[model samples]
Target: MKISILCVGRIKEKYWNDAIDEYSKRLSRYCKLEICQVADEKTPDKAPEALENQIKAKEGARLMAKMDPAALKVALAIDGKKLDSPGLAAGIEKAGLSGISHIQFIIGGSLGLSEEVLRASDKRLSFSDMTFPHQMMRVILLEQIYRAYKITSGEPYHK
Candidate 1:
């Protein structure tokens, strides 16, 4: 299976990059992994709701442009379904069994995903109700994906 993470903005901090690299290396054994980033729109401090929405829309458009239409799209949202690690593993396994060769996970910018991206997704997942920094979320998502693979394979790492 091929797994791709599509997110807005780049990880500028070295620590975050290191964490991502570690998970990427570990995940290489299970499936092909790709991380694609889109440029983020600048948001003014204390921006109005309308302005925030506009920023999200612009970022969403950039994300959509890079999306693979053929792949299963999963968007990450605070209100999305919450799943345990084993559940995520099962879901991924089922997708592959059903002949899905690729799964693309979308992570939005600080303002969150636009309606267009959310509506286009096959699934929406939430790690927690509390908001997280998008850069940190990338590493967390990678680790969970790795754990999912390990769980699917009945490996000891998942514990």
Candidate 2:
């Protein structure tokens, strides 16, 4: 049940850090969790197609660098398949019980994931069609993951 979140950019804001820490603490009881924050390429004020691709590719390289070849990889993307909590819980349970031991969730930079990164994922997941700040999305992702675990354990938190 080991979980890893590899994302571009640091969580500089104190409030985002606090929320992430709280979930990390709660999840410690269930599995080992590692959060890898990588440096993000600076975005242009008015990015052109080529410039945006370059930024995403740079961030993609950083994300790919942190990846483990054997881990079950899940990429977060706007166009990815959307799953309910129960569905995600089922997927998580299946992965855990199938001897996968480790799961890596990739949250791309604010500009979005590069084609290469998306292509490498075993699963692509989306919370919504609407966009969110990468920092806040991390917290939300953690909360949903925690909820998924609770559902898996037949715990009351998911009730």
Candidate 3:
């Protein structure tokens, strides 16, 4: 099994990097884990819809190029379906059993994903209805993934 997180922007803070490193290390025991960070386009000072869409399109293109075409692509969206840990584990296991070994998760930038990228995704997953910082989302995503693996393997994980 292989898991890839195709997220926009880099983790500049040391604490964020450290947390990701720790989760990545633990997750390595379960399967191949890759963190693909694409450069986030700078938002314009004017912040017009046209400019926002253009930036999203550029970022979306980069994200699409980085992922495997055959992998199951799941986009993180605010309006996406939210799943519990067990449900997440089951979904991943089912996909694996069905021969989809590679699972790539797409986390969009500040302005969110483009329509093109969202349409290309196989599933849209959400952690909550509330908005979160895109960078912070990465950490939460990693932790959930780690928990999912533990659940699948019947290991001890506290609620």
Measured against the true structure, the TM-scores of the candidates, in listed sequence, are: 0.98, 0.97, 0.97
Name the top TM-score candidate: 1
In terms of lDDT, which candidate is stronger, 1 or 2? 1
Query: Model 1 Cα displacement at 109 (Å)?
Result: 0.4
lDDT of 3 by residue, 17-124 (tens): 999999999999998999999999989787989999999999999998997889999999998999999999999899999999999999999999998899999999
- Cα-based lDDT for every prediction: 0.95, 0.93, 0.94
- Per residue, candidate 1 scores C-alpha lDDT tens digits across 83-109 of 999999999999999999999999999
Clashing pairs in 2: none
Among all windows of ten consecutive residues in candidate 3, which has the lowest summed lDDT?
42-51
lDDT of 3: 0.94
Q: Which stretches of candidate 3 lie over 4 Å from their true place?
A: none
For candidate 1, the 10 contiguous residues with the lowest summed lDDT are 150-159
Better-scoring candidate (lDDT), 2 or 3: 3
Write candidate 2's Cα lDDT for 33-148 as tens digits: 99999999888798898999999999999999899999999999988899999999899999988999999999999899999999999999999999999999999999999999
Give me the runs in candidate 2 sitting further than 4 Å from their true place. none
Model 1 segments more than 4 A misplaced: none
Better of 1 and 2 by TM-score: 1
